[model samples]
Target: MTARTLHVDPSNAEQARSWDGEEGSYWAAHADDFDRALRAYQRPFLDAAALHRGERVLDIGCGSGLTSRAAARLTVGGPVLGVDLSGPMLRVARREAEREGLDSVRYEQVDAQTYPFPEASFDIAVSRMGVMFFADPVTAFRNIARALRPGGRVALLVWQGLERNEWFRSFATALAAGRDLPVPPPDEPGPFAMSDPGVVRDTLTAAGFDTPELTGLERPMTFGRDAERAYSFVSGMLAWMADDLDETGRARALANLRVDIEAHATPEGVRYASAVWVVTATRP
Candidate 1:
């Protein structure tokens, strides 16, 4: 087999490895489940983009290509390109796109922070629960800006904050019943990295985007089909979190999490209140 070369940014090296390794595999394996959980964010994110017919689109961190497929359906006159850092996730994205017979949608396994797209090639860029993991947000956004035509727009959905998202906080607290899990720094390269609107606006402005519009949205996110299923899915997905614990400790954590999930169960599913920011910007 021929050797492959990657041109990922040094700042994103660790994330590229993690997303291209076990984490990516796990996400691909449970693609449908996670899709269901985050499905509520899709409509709002897309509405904010207001994609036009014939607009060339780019999807950043397009895990499993769900949003890419959606964009493809909207833009019949032009193709949609979805780029991500995870090989396994891209594999799943390709499979799903083929299964759905989405001819205009394409998937590329690349570090979007530095991918050299033809200048002014795209008319719009959209991300659903993506674009928040960049180690250098400004550099990444700037690189993306270079790919857009003049007046091109960007729409993204980002988690509002740790305290506002019960899905993560409840599960985290449950898992840490015995162990003290340190809170990650607010500026860490994680989901809530862009929670602060001021930082997001400043970063986009520095990256050549015009003043951004932010809208706070709250929605119900599904965890699973039922409480039992939710517990099984969540525990398995986060099993690694307790891998460092003793056997008894791991068992206890799982048991406590199970009870907590059960209490929040409804006929629809184990639902949680999630808050996010629907941010939109335009290149000058």
Candidate 2:
């Protein structure tokens, strides 16, 4: 493992560990699959960014560098720095960038919550389904604000409430297999942390950003081309759900998951409805 350039915030230590360990490894190994799942949102999210030529970009929690690479192309020779806590994902990101000949794109393994970024160094900061895992969102956004030049913009695509997301609801329901699973509080550091528009607005405001514009976006996230493939992908990603189950219980959960996934399969692909908030704010 490469040494991190800066200390991770104590609140983000567990997140750092997970994203740098098994979870990160899974994401890295299935980089293409994960990217394909979220590909539907890329265009709209990038469109909202409105990247200009020669504009430097900072991509927070940039897993596998897909968004960074896309931003690099839009920047037209500008530098794009992608920072994340996952060493495995960063390696994949670097390899993908090199493969694409995006010399202006770079990846670094660092926790965005507390990384000592050069102040006012970037023209734009963006995150796609990222920024939600920050344990101390206000502090993290403040740090991000300090990294941006005056009038610099920040664009983020974050999940909406868990109930509105069919992908998560269906999966969790299937995997629970009659067991009651508690949902994390909406304000906690997780995918749904920023699901509330009110919290997002207040967080950015407290972090020295202009009032943010929150736009709701709905889309279908592709899991795979068929039920079998989708089951393999999703089960692998979410296998931890069955960790506490006995062998028979685990089998039952897996069966339930397969059935649920198969129900959603279509000729085009196995896709599930998803909702997100596309938020854009500027550092004053």
Off by over 4 Å in 2: 2-6
Model 1, global lDDT: 0.88
Clashes of each: 0, 0
Per-residue accuracy of model 2 over 1-284 as CA lDDT, tens digit each: 63343368878888888888889999999999999999999999999999999999999999999999999999997999999988999999999999999999988888888888999999999999889999999999999999999999999999999988999999999999999987868988889999999999999999999999999999999999899989999999999989999999999999999999999998889989999999999998
Q: For candidate 2, give the lDDT of residue 180.
A: 90
The numbered model that scores best in lDDT is: 2
How high is the CA lDDT of each candidate model? 0.88, 0.93
* Candidate 1 regions with alpha-carbon error over 4 angstroms: 1-5
Model 1 agreement with the true structure over 106-160: per-residue lDDT tens digits:
8887888888998999999999878989999999999999999999999999989
TM-score of each: 0.96, 0.98
C-alpha RMSD of each candidate structure in angstroms: 1.7, 1.2
